[model samples]
Target: MQIKQRHIEVFDAIMAAGSISRAATQLNLSQPAVSIALANLEKFIGFKLFQRDRGFFAPTREALLLQDEMAQGLLVLERITQRVTEIRAGSTGRVRIATNGAMAINFLPSLIAAYQHKHSDVNIDILVRSSRQIADWVSTKQIDIGLIDTPVPVAGLDAKFFNLECVCVMHRDDPISAQKSIAPPDLAGRSVVAITGQHMVDRQLDTLLSAADVTVEKHISSYYFAIARNIIASGGGVAIIDPTNGKADLNDGVVWRPFSPKIYHELALIRGSNQELGKAPAGLYNLIDRSLQSLIGIGNAGDSNE
Candidate 1:
């Protein structure tokens, strides 16, 4: 025999409220209706679920066992109902996002703003970390989406190229900038300002420096972009940073020039290969594409290497 939902609801209600009268009030039914529903449920289960003495009802061991199962079933039903409601409204109850600190700080704010403009009811929780951490979070389903630096395989990730741009950064006018182009040896012995949070940028720079055999004095390892910008503006040292972070005018004394070694970063919108994009997240992802296209003066989003 098929157990109806009303049977489960009445059973759970009585177990929760511990009184037929209270269950009737919570279920918005007459006291007789709740009593009849529980009676029908007991008959279907082929056992008396409760023992009555005077006016009070006490649950039997079998009732307790059924209550445990019904509790879990009711929770699953509630979740299914909530999910259906959200889908009908064209939004998700929650969206978890992961991204590198640099992108989260500089880029994600605008993308989120654009998304909320249309789907304001959708909730967003942003996790900021290094690119490697973002990748791992996506893999583990801890985050629904990831925005990160690229050059990695997208085999197991549904990735969309967000943007690509040459690295341009600032430093106070020094002997290094006087030359039309900086040679690998020119960086030798000079103080270099690096950021701890921009992990991919640090790795790429380290690879280039290692290949060129350049040895420089490390001035500082900082997390704040403002501090890095300030250090370079105040003639503290040089910083290799993204153009997105180079918007403010520090001073005419500090000049932002393209680095001699041609290096670029690919920002990708990544999700699990098996996960399908919901309507709101897909719309937001498209908005991210539009914002990146505007920033880089590119007509389309695609891998430059391809």
Candidate 2:
């Protein structure tokens, strides 16, 4: 038998709140309207779904039995409505993503281009922040996906392996490049520029340096590694950056060399623990992985040249 959607809503509200007055307040409907909806629903179902006693409402055994089925049906309806909204908004539905500033600048452009080519209708909104902040956003469900490096473990988030890049950074025509390889001691007592955020790159740098008993004279700190790279190029200070970002800007007179002791950065895609990744998010995440792999290949191929 066909029943109005409002009837189901009223029934669900009463079950959830366990009182007609509370359900009316929760649903933002007048108490009289709630009573009318309940009476109408009882007529439709031809059974007492709830029992009223002492000015309170309580669900009957049949209502409790039907709760799960009704909730599932409502969820399906909500999802259908969301899909329709996306279509009307000129989207197949967009996945909101946030990434570390490094990835947003160094890796996201290429990944986005490739993803758009494959799924032109799918929209993505990307925000740039530190890895730590991105991880928090994922945990809180503020965004659908996050891309960042590890060591900033966000509780209740699922992480998928993305790609790895060398942690070595470069300076343009610096005397250090002439050396076949530089030792950890070579970076000692030098001025360095670094990124700062809740998920700062400084964590890895500090770990490596502390292990080696080295200290950096932090000259400047910013969220954008690109900004730090610019400072390094202008002879302000050396910036510790990823291979992808620094390599692309080589024309600006920055030459990258491997840091001694072999530091490497790992990238991962993160989401809330209970979040169900749909077709678009999964597809876009895969596309990003491929793009990063390609970038790594190109970086590896040119390792000999540097």
lDDT of 1 at 6: 80
Question: How high is the CA lDDT of each candidate model?
Answer: 0.70, 0.73
Instruction: Name the candidate that leads on TM-score.
Output: 2
lDDT, candidate 2, 1-306, per-residue tens: 476677778888988898889999999999999999889878888899988899778788999998998887777778888888755544476778888777777678777777777667798898987778989888988888888877556789888764444444556467776766555577788887767753334666778789889887885787676777778778866766666776765567766765555545567778789777777777776676677677667644334234
Poorest stretch of ten by lDDT in candidate 1: 297-306
Give a tens-digit lDDT track for model 1, residues 1-306: 667778889888877787888888999999999888888878777999878766567889998887778888888888888878866676665678887665666567867876777677788788877667888778777878888878544357777774444443446456665545444466777777887755566677778889999897875877745556677777777776665554434444655555656555567888888887676666666677677778677322222110
Give all TM-scores, in the order shown.
Answer: 0.56, 0.60
lDDT of model 2 at position 60: 87
* Candidate 1 local lDDT, residue 273: 82
After superposition, the stretches of candidate 2 with alpha carbons farther than 4 Å from their true spots are 1-91, 130-133, 161-165, 197-216, 292-306
